[model samples]
Target: MVTLTPLEAELLEVAGSVPDPELPVLTLRELGVLRAVHVRDADAVEVELTPTYTGCPAVEAMSQDIERALHAHGVRKVTVRTVLTPAWSTDDISAEGRRKLREFGIAPPRTRSASEPVSLTLGPTRTHPSEAPADAPIRCPHCGSADTELLSRFSSTACKALRRCLACREPFDHFKEL
Candidate 1:
């Protein structure tokens, strides 16, 4: 028979309740960041997670949130471990998460087909908004405009970039293909 401690189960539940700081529409579990939950002895809880991006600033805040959540669940000690060996990708983003992103006015990351690198090729030289890599084409969530302009490589959030709709001339956020 399989058994799970009360604390472990509560930890899992709390983790699920935590949402992604950048994209509030998705939970940590939806983002595949909540890798595993386990109880250490009677008073400690350990959580394994991976960040969407290596330099993602939310990691610290996330760890703190996890600790707070576990503590609230009556766990005396909490440990949050970051696993990076198997790096996270947009593919790890859940189907529901993708839908949530679109509904939130942010286009999901473009799909990278089988047996290909996750690289974006804007053009022969400088990359443009309209010209994505050969395998991926970024779609504007606001206007559904493939014809877009890369306003900036970075956006208000690390996971997204600033883009403008050529058709509507409205600035929008494009989830970084990475």
Candidate 2:
């Protein structure tokens, strides 16, 4: 594991505490995007962040939020760098984040290997969202039923898919595994 200096650790906590732009319910730390804080000088520091997905628009907002938070905490010349080399996986999301998402009427993504890239299929289009990507039955965040079916692959955001629970008859978003 990488060792951090005292100041870096403190800055990391501040930056990580910033709320996510899209999902206000979860912080950047819970989302698993805030990577590291490198103190270059006494007043200037650099922060590393990864987007939830490639070309994710939220990255810019997240960066600004982090910068604003650090600045309020007496940081100057803060630089939030976008890191994409290792990419991001849903598995990086903390358990608390998942619980929060579920509690907020969204289905949490199931655990998967971090190394596995999200797969895309080029099959014939179907009318129902439940036609493909048959990994497993998604549980409803409302009633906790395993009888939820996808309503649309695209929801409020690209990273989430819309689904409806058969048991509770409630519609919700599922954070698609990356």
Candidate 3:
């Protein structure tokens, strides 16, 4: 296992606390966007980040926020790098992040069984077979009811879908699992 020095640990903490611009409720760490933090020298720190999507508009803002956060914490120099080889998945989201998303009036991504087939949706126009089917249930985050309908395949962001609860008659966003 790798160990962190005091400065490196503090830098990581500050960098990880930077929140995603689109989803303010979750931090970089919670969203699993902040991948790694390395101390380059006595005054410089390097941060690695993975974007939820290739063209996500909020990634630039997130990078700036990370640099500002590190600087606020006394980091003299900060370098933020975007990494895409491994790709970002909904599975990277932490349990606490999912809970926070629900608390923020967004439905968390549904966990699929190993036997379930993975369906990928690229853009707003594309539809997936594995999406919440008519027969399948979508639990409402506010009402705790399973009576919900999909309003649209896309929500405010590409990572979520619009949904409404029949029980509470409230509209909400559901985080789509990639």
RMSD to the hidden true structure, all candidates: 3.4, 2.4, 3.5
Candidate 2 lDDT, 76-160, residue by residue in tens: 7999999996788888899999999999998998986657666677876443436644766678899988777777889999999
Q: Encode model 3's per-residue lDDT on 1-178: one tens digit a residue.
A: 7798887787888898888899999999999888889999989999999999999899899999999988888889989999996888888898999999999999998766656777765655423334546554667899888877778989999999998888899999989888
In model 2, the worst 10-residue window by lDDT is 124-133
Task: Order the candidates by lDDT, highest first.
Answer: 2, 3, 1
Model 2 CA deviation exceeding 4 Å by range: 113-135
Instruction: Give the local distance difference test score of model 3.
Output: 0.86
- The candidate scoring highest on lDDT is 2
Per-residue lDDT of 1-178 in model 1, one digit per residue for the tens?
Answer: 4476775676798986788776778888887788778888789778988988787789998888888877887889889999996888877777888878888877777766657776555546334644554445566787787777777778888778777777877777777766
Which prediction has more favorable TM-score, 1 or 3?
A: 3
Model 1 residue runs over 4 Å out of place are 1-10, 114-130, 133-135
lDDT of all predictions: 0.77, 0.88, 0.86
Model 3 Cα displacement at 36 (Å)? 0.4
Name every residue pair that clashes in candidate 2. none
**lDDT for residue 10 in candidate 1, whole number 0-100:** 66
Candidate 1 CA-lDDT value: 0.77
Report the number of clashing residue pairs per model. Answer: 1, 0, 0
Candidate 1 at residue 175, lDDT? 79
Query: Residue 20 lDDT in model 1?
Result: 78
